[model samples]
Structures are given as C-alpha cells and as structure tokens.
Target: MTKHHITLAGAAAIAIAVAAPVALAQDATVAKRVDKLEKEMRAVQRQVFPGGAPAFFEGEIAPDATPGQVVKSNSPVADLTARVDALESQLRALTGQTEQNAFQLRELEKQFAAYKAEMDKRVPPAAAGEPAATPASLPVVAAPRPAAPTPAPAATATPPKKPATPPAASAGKPDAARLALVKKVEIPSSGNEQQDAYDYGFRLWSAKLYPEAQAQLKTVVAKWPKSSQASYAQNLLGRAYLDDGKPSLAAVAFYNNYKDRPDGPRAPHSLMYMGIALDKLGRKADACKAFRELDEVYGTKAPQDVRTDAAAAKAKAGC
Candidate 1:
C-alpha cells in the first residue's frame, strides 16, 4: 500500500512538471501577440503621419497625393489650431448666451408669480393655527436668475512691450563673448608632436581606409601608447577591422584595447563588438557571457541608447 501511495505521488509530480512548460508557452504566445499589436499601431501611425516629424508637420504632406486622398485626409488639424485662437473670442460671447437664457427663464418665473398672486387674492386669509387654502399654501414662484457677467473689452493690439532690462550682475557678464571663446578653443594642434598622426588616423578611419587607418593608428599607439587617444585609436581600429569583414581580427583588437583600458569610454562598445565577433565565430555561450558583463558593470552608468542596444542583443541571443 505504501509503495502504491509513493507511485501515485510521483505521477502527480510528473504531471505538474509537464503542465508548467505548457503554461509558460501560452504566456509567451500572448506576449508575442501583444508585440504584434504594438507593431501594427506603429505602422498605422506611420501611414497617417508618414515621417519622423511632429503632429503639426505631419501634414506638411506630399505634393503628389491624389485629390481624393487629399480631400479624405482634410482633417481639422489646422482648423483646430485656429479654433484655439477663436476660443478666446467665443469665451467673450459665452456670457451673452447665459444672459439670454437667464432672461427667458426669469420672465417665465415672473408670469407664474403674478398668476399665483391673483389666485391668492380670490381666497380669504386663514386664522392662526388653521389650515390655509391649498393655492395660498403653495410655495413661492422660482428664484430670479442672477445678473449677467459684463462683456470684456476687446484686447487692443498694443505695441510689443520692450524687453525688460536684465539685472546688473547678469548684464555685466558677456555670455556671447564667453561662448565665442569656448567655441574657438580648439585642442592645440602644434602642442603635441604626435597630434598630426592622431588626426590623420582619425581621417583615415572616417574614410573607411581600414588597413591604412590601422597602420596610421598604430603610429599613435606605438608613439604615445599611454595617451587617452590611444584607446580611441584602438577602438577605431577594431571598428575598421569589423567593417573590413575581419571579425576574428576585430575581436583581437577590441579584446586587447579592453585589457589595456578596461575603464575607457569606449570599453563597453569594445566589449560589445567582441561579443559580436564571438557570435560571428558561432561561440554563442562565450558571447553571452561577454554581453552579461556589460549589463552587470555598466548597465546604469552607460548611455541609454547603448544599454538599449545591449539589452536587445542579449534578448535576441536568448541570454
């Protein structure tokens, strides 16, 4: 009997384990459906507004739209804006309607009051402690409507008021001069002997001269290896190789840069690309760990866009 009881309990446990995956699969399907709906909403918004511009410019509109399409789309979007201005004028006129309605209601109450007064005159006054005539006992006619609000005068087209004079402390400071100085403060060109080399490497990288850029970039790393720009140059070199379709070489470049300067501004991006290179190599597990490191250390500290990109990659890789 004990053996049978144990067997029954084990079967129940097996059933629960089987049910768990089924429930999770259903939830995942529901989540995917929600994602699909959100995508549809975005597609509809794009169809209505077309581009990335704001709601107002959404109708900046294509010249080639068919007459029917234009007519169909002739929304109150612009008129609504004009109506916002018209609302002020309408507010002034609103009191007129209220007054007109109140006057009509007041006339109605007065007529009813006069009729009551005439009927009461036809009946005798009742003695104290005695019941009064039914009509005499009736309540007084309705209260009179309150007086109308005075119409506001139209706003005059007053000349634009002069801008107020700024206070002394603020006026004494020349912010424009300060900004001009800041804008002109170019990093010293002749200050460092290797500046030309660094600048040339940057130009080459921008031009997509990967191998030549790497060669020029190496000049800076070899000459001024301890400088801050060395990390930037190394970051660019890894990018160059990645763009050149050399993932392994790119990984080597990024890994070396991170090893040398793990706390760099570019380090997170470098590590991210290293993971990409590993992904290209089909080393997914290692790639996942590398991505995990980015989340653990710098998720909050990193830029939002970078964090978003990293999270998306992690999700796509199912890590």
Candidate 2:
C-alpha cells in the first residue's frame, strides 16, 4: 500500500508539470493579443480625435493594463450621440432664423406696396395741350374750354319779354375761372372744408393741371401756414415743380420745406426730393452732400420709401 501511494504521487507531480507550461503558454498568447488589440485601439483613437482624447478619459488608466480584465466605456458612443444632437440643434436654429427673415421680408413688401399706392395717387399725368418746347420754369397750362354764344334777338321782336337773369353756372365752365377761384379761396383751419380744399388741389395735381395745382397749393400754404396740411402742401408744390422740369425752383421749394419744418412728417421726403432736384440741375456734388446729410440727420427715422429712394438716387448719382 505504501509503494502504490508513492507511484500515484509521482504521476500526479508529472501531470502538474506538464499542465503548468501549457497554461503559461496560453496566458502569454492572450497577453500578446491584448497588447496588439490595445495598440490598434490607440491608433483608432488618434485617428478619431486628432486633438486628443476627451477630458472624460484623462488619467483613467496606465499605458498598459493587466490582461484578462475587460476595459469598457460608453464614452465614444455617447460623444458621437452628443455631437449629432448639437448639430441637429444648430440646424433647427438656422431654420428658425430663415423663417423669421422670410416673414420680415413679406411685411416689408406689403409696406412698399402701400407706399407706392399713395405715391401714385399724388403724382400727376402729363398735360396733353402743353407745348413741346414749353419752358421748364413755366407751369403746364390746361386746355381752354369752348366759349358760349351770345343770345340773338327773337324773330317776333317783342312777342314776349322775359325777366333778365344771370345764366346758371354749368359744369362746362371755363377751367381758367375755376382755377382762379381755387387760388383765391382761403384754407380754413382744421375742418372738413380744409381737407376738401386740399384734396381738390391734390386732384388737380393728379390731373396734370400743374398751374392749377401750384396755385391752389400755394394758397393752402399761405392761408394755413401753421396747419398740419401746410407741410403736405409745401411738399406737393415742390414735387409739382420737380415734375414740371423746373429743377432749380423745385430745389428751392424742397429746401424751404425742410428748413421750415425739419421735424415735419414730410421733412424727409422734402430732403430726398431736394437731392433729386439738385441732381437734375447737374449739381451732383450738392446732391451727394444732401443725401449724406439725410442719412446723418434722420438715420432710421426717415420713412422706408424715402430711405430706399435715397439709396437708389445716391447710387444713380455715383455717390
């Protein structure tokens, strides 16, 4: 029994020795594979993040880690997901800004349309009967109405003598007389009548009756110098002269309107017109100076049309 036990122990020792080398060889192969895998992972990390690994990975491990232990982190995937989220957020912001810009552009177009309509109502058509060579300083004259014939004696001589009465005023009354009366009438202060009178002058301007418009607008300015409509009338008068091809006169009128009421509703319009008139008069330097002054003085307070028109005019004048 003692001899049999010794033989079993020797067998057990030889088997243990054989198993130890195989286990050590397997461990060495596994360690080499882990080192190769770590090198490949580090190469991928360098390619992915040229600047460096993110701060979250700082000081977390030695250059080499022990084999048979797993290193696990969701950081790379989490970082990719966070970057995608940020890109989506930025895209959404840009889309919102684009929508807002489109809305503002639509609103600006609406405002421009309304302003153009108002300007159309104020501008006049060219006169038909105006001479081709009419002087710019002179106002355009409306065609004269035909005269009515005097009554002749009745064939029966004294058959019946009717009472003498003034002829009823007709719709075909002479334009000259109507225009004279328009110039003579005084503009009342703050009433419907005042508004009507101003509207009538505006109608004349729209009809291309420049002489009539000038006369009526001048009367409104003279009679209601302190009224709100005075600035409007003055500005219209300047435009009338400008459209009539009298640039010097238009410049003077526009300057007067701006000088008299720099804060008036029409002041910026007057300045813009003044610049146009100066340009028409071949005084480009003065015109550019006027445009520069307009921006310096009004900044954004000027109407959008005035601002746009000023920019266009400035470009045209090469300012």
Candidate 3:
C-alpha cells in the first residue's frame, strides 16, 4: 500500500509540472493580445481626439460598484462595440453642426441681397463721364416734379443807384468791390435753416446784388426743395435775372415757378413777371397769352400789386 501511494504521488507531481507551462503560455498569449488591443484603442483615441482622450474607457457601467470599484467587461468585443458607438455619436454631432452652419450662411446671403436692393432704389444713375455721387451729398428723396431750368452765371450783383431804380442793365458781371460787399453780407443762422437761407437771398436781392442773390436762391432750392421757401426763392430768382437784363433766362425762370407751383403765394407775381420778360424778348403774342392766362386763372384771388401790374402790362401789350 505504501509503494502504490508513492507511485500515485509521483504521477500527480509530473502531471502538475507539465500543465503549469501550458497554462502559463496560454496566459501570456492572452495578455499579449490584450496589450495589442489596448495599443490599437489608444491609437484610435489619439486620431479621433487630437486635443485629448477621455478617461475610464474600458469599464462603461458599474451600477452596483462601491467607490474605487469598477465592473469591467472581460470581452474585447464588448469594449470595441462601445468605442464604435462613441465614434458614431461624435459623427452625428459633427453632421448636426455642419447643417446649422449652412443654415446661418443662407440667412446672411438673404440679408445682403435685401440691402443691395434698397441701395439701388436710393441712388440714381450718374450721367456718362460723371463721377458717382457720394452718399452724404445724395438727395434725401426722389423729386416728384421735373427740375427747374438752370440759369446762366452771366448776371452779377451790385448796390442799386436808387431805392426805386434797379441796377444798370449791362453784362452785370461783379467787380472786385461788389464781390467784397457780397462777402460781407451776413447769412443768418437763427435755427430756421430754410428761412435763414431765404432771408440771405432776399437781402442780396434787395441790395441789387442780382448775381449773388441768384446763386443763394438756387442753393435754397437745391438744399431744401420741399420747403415752403422754395416758391419764394424760385420767383425771386426770376426777378434777379430780369433786373440783370437776362430777359430770356428770366422768362424761363418765371414760367417754371408758375407751372411747378401754381398754388404758391408768389405764383401770380411769377406769371406777371413772365409776361414782362416775354415782352422784353419781343414776343408780343406770347406776352399777351401770359397776361390773359393770369386773369383767367386767378381773376379775384390775385394780389392788388399783381392785378395792377397785370392790367398795365395788358394795356401796354394791347391784349
């Protein structure tokens, strides 16, 4: 019985010695595969997140674990599947961000198109060879009526010889002394811009400074074409030309006032002046027409001065 026991112990020891190496080799192979898998996972993390990788990627769930305890999955396939899910989630997030960026770009394009259309409406086309107008100097709005005639710069300004008499009818060019006087004329700034401009022009006209008056009146019309003073400035401009003996230019100025602002305070005066200008131009028939039209349009509403002037002009022209 003792010998049999010894033989069995020897057999058991040899069997254990041979099985140890095989088990150790299997464990080493499994550890090497795990190491290779870990290396591949780290490489994927670096490629996916160049900034940095997330922590604790192997054990995703530990619902019943205490502090410092994790329930790790033994299967490499489960870990790889979890990583694939993370990659898909990141791709979905990137796709959503791209869609949002495309939507914002479309909105910006729409806004730019609307702004361009608005600009086109505000600015008028420049004439050939003319520089484009700056936005600061552009007109506030489009004018409803045709522009008035532009007067020649031939007429000049000077003090009249007498209160009742006008400056001498000549080339009407300003000498150095007259220009110096014009420079001395005070342009008021009493907070009423249109009124102040008109007042300055009126003073120039009253002083028999026809050229300066014409220029100032034209500026008033250009700067504030919608102001109440526009009518007054336009009518006075015609008289300035008439006093300077540019009867043809005067006729055009007066006719424009009457046609453009028929309901203006100075419309009747403009019509009467227009007839006088036409008479000076030796168009008796047209002068007669102007005088007759004034009586027909504003028979009773005409001012006393306009009425008296019109009647005298009619008699002189045999209308």
Best by lDDT: 3
**Candidate 1 to native Cα RMSD, angstroms:** 43.1
Which residue pairs come into collision in candidate 1?
none
TM-score, candidate number 2: 0.43
Best by TM-score: 3
Question: Which scores higher on TM-score, 1 or 2?
Answer: 2
TM-score of each: 0.39, 0.43, 0.46
Pick the winner on lDDT between candidates 2 and 3: 3
Question: Tens digits of per-residue lDDT for model 2 on 108-192?
Answer: 7797567435433432222211111112432222212212222211111111121011011212543555545433422222224
lDDT of 1 by residue, 1-319 (tens): 9999999999999999997896555445444433443444454455544686553222222232221111112345334334433543454465466568679989977975674364234222221001101111212111122122221111111111110111111225536644333223122133234554455445444554445456555656666767766777676666666666776666677666666778876777766766665666666776686687677667788656556666666665667
Q: Give the poorly placed runs of model 2, Cα more than 4 Å off.
A: 1-191
Q: How much lDDT does each candidate structure score? A: 0.51, 0.57, 0.59
Descending-TM-score candidate ranking: 3, 2, 1
Kindly report which residue stretches of model 3 are placed more than 4 angstroms away from their true locations once superposed.
1-175
